[model samples]
Every structure is written in C-alpha cells, then in structure tokens.
Target: MGLTHEFFLLRSESDDEPVEQVVLSDNLVLYIWDSFRWIPAFNPSTKENHVGLNYHGITLIRHEGANLLKDICLSWSSLFSLAPSTLQLTGDFVMDENGNGRYEKLNFTRDDLTKPLTTLAAIADRAFLENYIIVHHGI
Candidate 1:
C-alpha cells in the first residue's frame, strides 16, 4: 500500500467543526514530504497543538511557518526533478509491483501540479494573515 498526505484550513487550531480540505494529489504530498521541515525558529513542537509533519501524523503551520511553507510549495518547480524518472522510477524503495514508485510516476511535468500547489500556497498565505491555520494530515 502507498501513503497519502492531506491538507486542511481551519479558522482556529482548536476548532475542528469547520475545516476546509485543500484538494491536492497524494502524489504531490508524498513527493514533497522528504524535503519539508520546520524553520527551527518556529519550534513547532514547543506548542501543545503542533506536531512535526511526518509520514504518520498531523502537523500544524501557523503565522511565519505558513509563509515559509508557501515559499516551499511555490519552489517545487525547480526543487525536484521527476521529469526523467516519471515513467520508470527504479529503486527498491520506489518501484512497486507495477514498476513505478507507489505514485511517484510523474507522467506530466510539475506544471500539471503547479495549480494545486499554488492553491496551497495561497491557503498558506491566508494562514499567514491569521485568517486560518494550515493542518497537514500525513499518511
């Protein structure tokens, strides 16, 4: 089985009744997971409600972290090189029975995922504005 990551927007970190799910492909989430990290100054773990973005947990991005996260999402175009490995990604950890990295096959360029990534960036911008909190539910 493969893993997936889900994103959500919340008015308050404490409020769970209303969370807007940010639609994005699991492939995009998994692709970016390896490089995603906290900005240290944020010291996310020091917060009671925060958690590190991991393969099996939830993570929260607030204020400055939101802005930094936006930057990270926006830079994915050049941050990764999946073009050549899209069709035939070969590696024991990557290749599945189908001969592709679980969902690592990037049949299209980052251009295809740019829109959703941009959308996430926009949501992060909102989080920076204190209008929302970015919640990443990882698989």
Candidate 2:
C-alpha cells in the first residue's frame, strides 16, 4: 500500500503585472493524502508573496520510495514572460514506515497560476496540453 501524504500551494510576491497592475497579496494551498493516493484534505494560506527578484515555484509528491527531482511543469508563459514574475520553494523530507524516503508535504510559490502562454506560444505548435502536464514523479 502507498503511504499518506499532503500538498500545499504557496503564492509569491514577484508577479508579472505591469507596474500599474501589481497586487500585493499572496496565497497558497495544501492537500493531505491517504495511503491509497487519495487526497483526504487540503489547506490554503496567505502571505506577503514577494521575497525575491527572480520568481520561483515548485511541486512536491510524497510517494513511498527514494528519489529526488530537479524539474517540474509550468505554463509556457511561466517559463517565458507572463504573470508569474517570481518563484520560491520550501519542502520537507522524511522516511515512511515502509523505509521509503518521501515528502510529507510540499510548498509551491508563484506570482500567478493562470497566466497566459506568451513566450512559449510557439510550443503549442508542437504539443497538446497533455504534453506539458505535471504528474507525480514517484520514487
């Protein structure tokens, strides 16, 4: 059986709105999981949002195994130039009863999630939405 887990969504302050469109609020979400890969609950929170110059965000999947990831999926605009003007990530690591290393919870921080894909608009020419989707990279 899989282990229990949780998820969180963190909003950052470095958004990509024009100087005239900047908003100063941050938001985040956390999703809890059960042994069968089902989300039992979720939590959301808010903060100041802006903490750096280059925007950052991350995704964490707590699976029953041992592994680490270096990359994740983002909207083409997020990779390019869009509403996501900032990014940051903070997560935790632990071992489950099965002796597998996993993340109990994940934290993601972005300026915005619904930004348009202006930079990688060209990418759409080669792939569909399924091509860029982010799935759990279990270990």
> Model 1, range 1-139, lDDT digits (tens) per residue?
2445777888987788545566565566655655465431122344554324645566777775778777887787444434443333222246657876553334545455666677777788887886677777766
Residue by residue across 1-139, what tens digits does model 2's lDDT show? 1231121211222322211111211222122111112211111123222221111232222221101111111232244343234554333577888999966543333434223122112222222322221122111
| Residue 76 error, candidate 1, Å | 1.6
Error of 2 at 74 (Å): 9.4
TM-score attained by model 2: 0.16
Query: In model 2, what is the error at residue 110, expressed in angstroms?
Result: 2.5
Best by lDDT: 1
lDDT of each: 0.62, 0.24
Supply candidate 1's per-residue lDDT for 116: 69
Show where candidate 2 strays beyond 4 Å: 1-103, 112-122, 126-139
